[model samples]
Target: MFGLGPAAKSLREQEEQAITVPASKLLLRAVLNLVVAWFVFDEARGPMAWIVVQFKPSLATSVESSDTVNVVMNLLYYGPVALLIAWFFGRMGRWPLVWRRYGRPLVRRVVDAIGSRSGAGTPGKAPTGAKAQGEVVVDPWWAFRPLVGHGGLALLDQETAAGRVGDVDHQRLNRALECVRDYPDRLAALLDAVREHGAAACAHPSGTRDLPGRHSGRHDLLLRQVRLGSAEDVPKNPAAYRGVDLAIDPALLGTSLLAVGPAGTGKTRRLARPLAEALCLQALAGTAVVVVVGAADADLGPAEWYDVVVAPGDPASRYGLDLYGGARRLEEAVARLADALLPEELAPRAESARQALQQVVVPYTEAYGRPPGLRELALLLRGEPVAWDALREALRAGGGLTDHQYELAQRERMHGQVDDPGALLADRLSLLDRPALAASFNRTSERGGGERGGGRGAGRPGAELPLFAMHALDHPLRVRIAVPEHSHPEAARIIARLAVGQFLYAASTRQDRSLFAGLVVDDASAVIDVHSVRSLQRLRGAHAGAALLLRTLMDLPESLRTPLFGAVGGRMAFPGIAPWDGKLFAEAWGTVWVDERDVTRAPDTSGGIIKRSWRAVRTILAGERAQTESVTTRRVERRRWSPSDLAQVLPGGHAVLSLTAVDGTPVPPLLLDLQG
Candidate 1:
């Protein structure tokens, strides 16, 4: 049901009816069976049969020994008939359970025999111990109603009966089932893909990584957990999270995460890569929407691994990004655009920038019945007198302005056209008008058709690919946008910011919060800003989260450090971080009370010279000094992780991590061995 949406409710009800029975009816069946056996015994006990029986009879009973023996013999003959009757009526729910227990062993034996004939079951094993036990095999019928709740296995039986899943496909399924027997999540994913797609689940996204040799980690995407690594068996970790399968999940990530590490740390390998993989699989399963923003050089996954891959410079991939994010209200679109383009330094006075955008956005949208693209918006915000003349003429031609509104628009042009805030916005907007990003922000200004993302939101007629509109986040869309940060640094920053702003704004307003919305940025130095941090903090109540990876906290101004710390519920410190950066982490994790012991020695006050000589002689001879001493034990406050410990003491290939679930469950800072 995680991804199944409205259909999940109906499916759930059907499964409940199919798999369960009422407790009262079950109790009644048990009582009735006993009564039936007693009446049968009364009929059978005519003293015509004999077997082993007590020679001494009970005083309470009137029946003789020969009659009791007759009952036992008759009961043996009638047992099969009575059991068949109960199988059909009294214990309908019991058969499926019985099949699960007995049928599995039977199937295992048959498969083993088949394998032995083929010379594949020749491996040696101990015959008398637990190692001799057979595998827990897949029972498709038994698993149908309880696990793999999606439409995966739902159609297999029908297809099998119709001869659609052939002998080869049946064997294929059996082998697949053997691989995923312990992972129900993977089983559902596989069967669902084969039903909808006719391909293996790992191969569905155009690349195969969920296979054992391909992906080197344990993933339970059904529970929304991907094991990052094992926590080190050390005292720094609380017993609950210590030396176990440490992980990142919706609860921990729902509040957002800030991973601070230098280049060699396993931040990408341990954190971002696994989370992205889970989100991609979830998208296929209809459980999540994940937008991954990384540099063109980053090896996140392959191109076919995503539903939409927006690589602007790559001609083979031709998707455009929506400028307005498909907002209905003019003000909402304007605000989102302004929030994205405004410089981080001017956040405190952002209202002015918003006003500047609102003025241009309202007039331009009124004239065209659609919001302006980045190029058009940049023209308006640039305070260009010629651009203003063109816009006013278009508005007058459309008759979208009233006498009072027209007067206000005129004054706005005359006064703030060449002002600071609007000029700043114009400069920021101009960054997107570059050549490297020619394929992006091509959302055409056409009403209702803006969502089509092809020509409606497309570029260059016949060759235009659909634009990755922000509204797509409303569904379980898996999108990967690779910004060419190395070649075009500033524009990359803007694109990263745009993706972040769009995700937060669109996710906040989603009517369906069932899908977990996630944003992953590989190198977040260019992305984090004041408003984003603030917006991310407020995301706790929404159905969204983000993972921002940075080399250090110094990239942000001093004012934003605490806010960045507060915005995210999960924090990770990789080895090789600077002591100054570690200081903030030390402060964030705070302190813990620990026992401290102190000892004080009393000086000898015995008879003068003689005692002093004796002590010196003993100390010199025995290498010890004896004295009366006192000890004191008390609890004292100490930093949970010191700055020095975070920076220098952490071993290579390890990090200190802390997490908080979406429901406010906290995990203390603990060390984890990434290589493990």
Candidate 2:
């Protein structure tokens, strides 16, 4: 106390003197101004007095007397005016002392709370008494409580840095989060606080930079709003990374990706690699299902037929092909599948083992003009099992049979030829004595059988029409029956309709994998009819996502476009080598169409002469850019170049990608590999 005695006394004296100084001066100024104003406007004054006298001569004399009295009274008015001035000075004096003691430290705390960094990054504290424009002061606890209620929000106030973390009624904040009707209103207070405190001190950055906005946790989720032209131009190589190709990250948001290109643009070949990869992934995971649906069953023919006899080990296990162990099991499963999925009348014919005897017995009797011997017919009916070995042996014997005898036999029948007449005759003469033929003894057995008769509507009776044959065995995963190339467009449409039906049924019936990974229908426009395409509306109802591929944007009829094209969640495009169609597709998908510009030094050449390279451009469903080339000839004998040629000449896969989200957000540059 002694050490501070002299200094403390001096400081107190200075403070008192400083307070009185402003008070004394303001009082003097107020009194002087009031007195001056009163005298100058006195009753006998020069300018105003003359005007009043002239307007009313009689009252002018009387007014002069009253004015003198009023001047005196105005002097009295100066007393209160002086008091007000003193009061204002006194208030101003108090503020300085307060700032020196408590105010400076508060300001320091605020500045320390917020770092120096700007650009709306990081958050910092606002100074005490710092206020945003139009923001009213309210209980800070009210603001803190609502923010905390959002869950996962860290309470970071200016005082937090000063070790003064306060309690917020988190329950209220959580309620707000659960019922956030007006996001802008809900975030208004927080955004105001952020602006005052600066971004560095705020718990979260406002999403907007130029203005205030609330940012979500996902930084990668950009809400970039932009106006897209009919055709948006893209870079040839959007992704700078060479080897690391950008692919559909299955882990991210689900998508409906469309891959479009003209015929022979390597569309199928490009997809084959990914298809194989997808199949491999499914096989390896043992959880995914792969279903291939296409028209001609030739690709699956080996699985249906050869596997029955050879019982071969997994032929292409890497590619996920597993054959059934036995023909009976396969047939039974196929039958079960047909019964469960198809209408009752459309089931495939199931030939019993007893009916197989007609192949040998009828042939001998019909052609040789006699019935096959009883022993031969009996042997054929109750025959030794015709294993692969026996069939191979029969082919080896020179009596018009060999390992490839059946195939050769089929070819001969197709060409209406036969061999070994004598041997067939000997066998046929004895068939008349067989007990099985007793009822129809007079009628000669016909070797060539008519088409199996069954079913109506979808399949006609005795028409020998190709039918969808799906096996219902407990497949390890899923299976898809595809539309064949030879199938009529109508048939393909029906198949697609059935495909959707299958997905819906599976979704409703099975709890496991209820959400299909995705449905990818290629060349959809050519194959799917308007009604069938419209059926896509019910996809989500069926709990399945679908990605459809079309050749051109025009391929989809206007009626179907409104629903099918409009409903897509994402879009991608690839321009192919055709000027007209390619440009149309490009414009439809909103991708920029870049043509080949010859910026060379030819005297006759225009400075920026661009070649009308492609006539048609194809866009993937996702609106990603792809390059398609066209063949243009100067004359009949000129060279013909295809899209493949252009693709090869293109500097880095020669593709452009346009991506738009359901919310109309423009996606940044990305590369979709359409290569094998």
Best prediction by lDDT? 1
lDDT of 1 by residue, 424-489 (tens): 887887777765565466555443334432111224533534567776666656788888787777
lDDT (0 to 1) per candidate: 0.69, 0.35
What's the CA RMSD of model 2 in angstroms?
28.8
Deviation (Å) of 252 in candidate 1: 1.8
lDDT of 2 by residue, 208-292 (tens): 1111121212111111111111211123332233333333322211334455556554444344223322432332222223344
| Candidate 1, poorest ten consecutive residues by summed lDDT | 204-213
Q: In lDDT terms, how accurate is model 2?
A: 0.35
416 Cα displacement, candidate 2 (Å): 42
